[model samples]
Target: MSTTEKSNEKRCERDGREKVDKFRRFLAQFCATTVENLLLFDMGLCHSFPFIIIAALTGFPNKHNLNETLSLTPIEASWLASIGYISEPIGSLLSALITDALGRKVAMMVVNIPLVVAWFLMYSASSVWQIFLAIVLLGLGAGLMESPIITYVGEISEPTFRGVMIAYTHFGYSLGAILVATLNIMMPWRMVGLVCMFTPIFTTIALCFVPETPLWLLSKNKTAQAEKALCWLRGWVPKESVAEELQSLQRYSERYKSCESCIKKDQKCIHPLPTLAEKLKELKRKQTLKPFSIVMALFCISVFSTTFSMSTYIVQILKAYNIPMEPDEAAAVLSYVNNLGNISFLCLIRFTGKRYLYLTILSILFLSAAVICGYGFMVLPIGYSSFPDLSPNFPLENSNLGYIPFVCIILSSFCIFCGINSMAWQMISEVFPYKTRGTATGLTAALSYVLSFIGAKTFYSLETTLSMPGVALFNCIIIAFGLILMYKILPETENRTLEDIEMHFSDNSKKLTDRKIPKLDLSQIGSAKNNSNMPTRPVSIKGIDEQNNKKSGIGCDNRSFVADS
Candidate 1:
């Protein structure tokens, strides 16, 4: 034991500890940011790419003419515009299987393939059908990616991070819209479409380095892998705490699967793999149904908010209402404002609870849309002027009402972006128990997109028939219904653990299992056995030996314990 040798050993030990600490921090940081980035890349691009295409087409219809260039009539062009939404439900349905079977990372990868193809098709699109085909593929990618991406982010991030991670869906969407607005100004629509292809490509490459979600790994029975993944995710924590955290997730996984089973039943009887019908049945059992209903209501509100259609036809809608700015310029400004709103909401999400944020946003949107409708009603009698050549058959009576519609859209975009658009995605991830999350989320997405398809397809006709104000009024009513449903049904999930949320739904079952069972008077039984030293006598400890009193044999009935002497 030389002094020099001891000094060298101490230095080595300190260096080893430092290295371990650094690696742990690196793992934690990597897991948090990397998973979220992947989610944003997959979901945001898919969700917004179609919006970008529509933005460009709406902002510069004459330049990118389907009528002149591709021979698409008005009806055909409208159909083509909405066909992407038509295919979304199918993609959404398929995503449940993909996510459950292939894992979240792989599901995202598969969805990106279609999106890349869709972009390339848009780049080389020679006819309306080719464009339609491109959008259909885009819809597929968007549909499949939506549920899985939300689920993946929800499962990977801490509860504190889940809101922001889910909010990435909106952030990604706004970014794409901004890109479309800016790029359309800089280049041709085709080139912009080509440029969009790069996002999915780059994201796909980046995803290869990211780990799969620990929750999904646990669902697939990969306990070892799940522990490793969870450890890395919580790597900044002490090693012992990480192990405990992993154990908590495993327990949650088990309880989530068997929450519907009887409290006293043996664990083996609790069915871990429920059929779709059984899952649906479980959902109908009030406890699970409440959250499921709340999620659906939120999705419906978000989908029908008609912000998507407004974004798509921002130029036309603005021009129709006599917005003073050029349609292209107005579209770009609105897109930028909408992007800013999304960013603002993402930032605000970290500070607020989900319940308050959702209600507040929806209320603002409802009021804003109502004001727009009232203005439309008020202005109709006064005679208004709009861009003349834009819609000749629908002639404009001249007036300077342009600023009014422009301000309305700014307000509308701000409200929609700040509210339902981001909240719905975050809520979907927060509400569902992990056991049925993939299927439940997929169903919600499929239904929402179906509503979206209807809204997009009917939007032009609705505006033509009912006018912009009427459309706003229609949306206001839907928002009102959503607000009611949400207030009654939506639970506050902000900063709450997924286990806590699941437990909220399982309280009734927990009550049954947690009911106090009467304890036996073991002390009394012990005293009787010790004092009497009786082999044949049955000692009553609560009701354990009540049945033995009926036995006539020397030995007490086995239904109750017999004292041995």
Candidate 2:
């Protein structure tokens, strides 16, 4: 080759290398943020450990000598299995206060305290009461962490990645459950608890390194810090690189703060604090009421789908169904399948819309439940009869039928994790407006846990009264109804920003008129005008048309004004 040609080729190679390096850096930056958010989600591991532990204790009492060691009664075992869910409501309520007052990152770290103590209590627990106490603490920690983490992820993630990020909460949970279940197969329950205690401690240490979400900082009126945090979260980019997003967050914060009534006496205000009745009236607004109703309904559907009940009672349920595999082994297998489903969800959510994916998943879930119910009826001779003492070990002639329940359970679990279960939590982070997100999420989550508590607490009784087949049939019906409701009302949220979502639920007649206009700083406007790099876009101001601007002698322009800053 000629010397000039060789030089040109070398230049081309250098250009290619630079482009590859740029892409790598971009990928690494987002990946770092994703990993940090996911570590926070490890709280789910602590949250789910109790359910699997209870399953192990009840499913293999003789193998683990828990009956001989603790003399636990069946009633006590049922309480032990279900009691955690009841405490979650209280924790969720407290989390709202903490999340709003202290900030999301602090709320997340504070929750780990209860989790660590709970695990320690479980490790040292001797009596049933001690175990009960541990389980309650577990529930408390789970509730306390739930709202803030979801809120944090939503606030920090890019819109393109938000669905996957929110869904990771379920991924974290399934991974945790799988770990605990696998551990149970190999070790004693107490030792497993001891090993699990370190997760929260490690989580706390790791959280100290992650930044508080920029939106929360902006809400607290820390503009510079919000910029810095936003910059770091976006991979240590320059402030100007994220200026557009930072300004958008600023607008949201300012809008919320402007409309809120002053509660502090020091902050002088002419308006009085809203009365109790007036405050209740505020909640009745379309923005708050609609999303709250939708989320609560979703939670109800999720709970009655038997997802939590199955998790808490998987071992017992499998044994009752006379599955071909050992109950513990089967439970572990299902946990693995659940994790796979969560992984599938994380992948599918990127390409599919939320409403369609959810509806499709629920449809499959209904079919799986129906199949389980049919299998139960076929194998059990005394179908739907109250037979609490029915042996799970089937005769040789019916052994082949055992695989049906096992396969059906695996499919049901997969569908639950892939769509209905994860989507409920994802919607919690998505549907609510920024101003009321913390309180709204807490309220919705608390009620959801209440439903879960009822479902879990009543599982044994329901199974006895309705029979195993009856329980499956009931779940099938609930899933079918929930699917229909969702089809009618669930809105598409794919690729939409938080503001767009909030607007979707707002009263159309009042949306434009009622929107609070944020007061702009004159200095920022001047700076933005002088800075050639700043982008300009037209902004619509309510009650200010082009003719109004012209009449006011402001300037000659189009229908919308430009707010470059």
Best by lDDT: 2
**C-alpha TM-scores of all predictions:** 0.78, 0.82
Flag regions of model 1 displaced more than 4 Å.
1-68, 236-241, 257-283, 381-400, 508-565
Model 1 agreement with the true structure over 1-565: per-residue lDDT tens digits = 9999999999888778656754554456445555445546445445545544554443346354444354444455457657878788999989987888899888887888888898899889886678789888988888988777878777776654556656656766777667777676676668877988888888777778667887778767898887666656655353464554454455445444543432223132334477777766654554455566766767678767646665555565666676777676777897778778887787887787667787887888887788777877776532222212234424235556657656867877887788677777777776666656788888888888887887778766776666666777888889888888777666666656564455455444333223121222334323333321111122112232333223311111110011111
Deviation in Å, model 2, residue 10 alpha carbon: 18
In terms of TM-score, which candidate is strongest? 2
Q: Give the Cα lDDT of each candidate.
A: 0.64, 0.69
State the weakest 10-residue window (summed lDDT) of model 2.
556-565
Please state every model's RMSD to the true fold in angstroms. 12.5, 8.3
Q: After superposition, how far is residue 145 of candidate 1 from its true place, in Å?
A: 0.5
